[model samples]
Target: MSAGAAAIRVVVVDDHPTFRIGMSALLAATPGLEVVGQAASRAEAVGVVLGADPDVVIMDLDLGDGSGVDATRELLARRPEVAVLVVTMLDDEHAVYDAIRAGARGYVLKEAQPQEVERSIRSVAGGGLVLGAGVARRAMEGLAARADARPFPQLTDREREVLALLAQGLDNAAIARSLFVTTKTVRNYVYAIFTKLEVKDRAALVVLAREAGFGGDER
Candidate 1:
């Protein structure tokens, strides 16, 4: 926290003391970063996040007392500006979707290289979303399985198609091309998707899709 230091304040939340220590050391020694706090449990993690007001939170999705997903939700609800970057061993499709639902800005596997983790923190801090290598695939499969069953069941054909692509992580351009429509129309469809689904963002929509049966198949 110096003049033009380029530092990103971060907190490490993991149950394993050893991993926490290692991450703390790495973040402390890395350029443009400062390890502001550490937490070992769900409640502790929430407290540390709220108290420290760190720019980025490096968290494990599996905490001792509460799910890391819930912690992320609480942290974001309290301070939505604070970014949550999930750095955990849970890479399953459901786990990934759950993290997204909880409002994580990024996701990275614990097995990722140290630099990759740092990059993720920086990316989230700078307002860019990030995801681990295999997490996107998991999300996509999760989305596909969800498209089979309609969450709304009341959406028209176009709205359902747009929602399906939205759950696939497609922005307006991609959705437009896929549906042979203009970007403006795609944006309108996206608006309708959110309005009908009663979700706020793409992450939440994707989670709903999986819950609706979007992840049972890979293709």
Candidate 2:
């Protein structure tokens, strides 16, 4: 951020009013950043970004009315040049990976210091991928846990679990019972797995899973 360089234009998108205000104020006071707009939901996020044309968007994972992941995906689809940085309370691997899959350029926990947030925004705005220290470690651990031996590595850990159960000839209800999730949730995971693996039918999916060394365990 040079003295004469343009300040990075930014939009703050969060469901929490206090958090949004605080973040906007911090960015407003920062030397090389400018707070251009604010939004509280997914629709507002897209509207504000479209209207403001900010260089960066600070997004939350949960919006009261809709998901920030969906918002990020929509925003990037319409404005591919705009950089998105997810600043959310969720630190789970699924949430983090989902945000990244939705095209977030950076992911940082809400607990990150103001300085860290500012640095991440600037880094993403400049075309760099940024992940908070804890987030980086968690992401690495998730990857290491699946390390090469796991089939369909693109699928999340939970998705892999569902696939393994499905390969074992368990129906959605059985999977739901085994995983302690609702049947609908298991169905959704199965759909996502099918789409990701490009398998058209259940039998084919099971065969593919078996060939890849999954579903061998009794569980």
Candidate 3:
């Protein structure tokens, strides 16, 4: 930002032409930032970043030609020093985590204020990580939830409950009565639980559930 100091060069990669152009214009107008290149697909992104050698790359998750996550991974593999900041409409936990795993330095929704986007670009360019407020909260909550995860994490809550009841030596009719559900519904849940856990029958399921400490409560 200061005199004689070089501005941070940046590249914008998005599938939408309007967004890419708008973002480029915004960065070009901002002090201490320079718009070096623009790309609209995975292949183009790699080529542009390599050619421009930007300090930061603004990436979108949905690239019509290919995925931005894959592009980020390929770009970082070739240019490890370049930081990638994902700016897109996707705010789901899966999308956020996938981008992080793909070596993105920051993730912010497209709805983020222009000022916020500018700050994120500066942060990542300086080797700092950034996330939008909502993204950060969801990421942290997901991590915390994983830290204390329960057994059979793949099972739904109701399925786990059925498994637990089965471990307590309850038959389908008993489980149906206990859960206030019809016998057919209980049977369906039991079938699903068996399929998910990959147990051949009730005996194996009960053994596995008991070992995992699921059936300790008195009936």
From the highest TM-score down, the ranking of the candidates is 3, 2, 1
Model 1 bad stretches (over 4 Å):
1-3, 145-219
Model 1 over residues 14-86: C-alpha lDDT tens digits?
A: 9999999999999999878999999999899888888898999998988889899999998899999999999
- Candidate with the larger TM-score of 1 and 2: 2
lDDT of each: 0.85, 0.92, 0.92
Residue-level lDDT of model 2, residues 65-90, one tens digit each, is: 89999999999999999999999988
Better of 1 and 3 by lDDT: 3
Q: Provide the global lDDT of candidate 3 against the true structure.
A: 0.92
Which of the numbered candidates is closest to the native, going by highest TM-score? 3
Pairs that collide, model 3: none
In the predicted model 2, the residue pairs found to clash are none
Candidate 2 Cα lDDT to native: 0.92
Candidate 1 Cα lDDT to native: 0.85
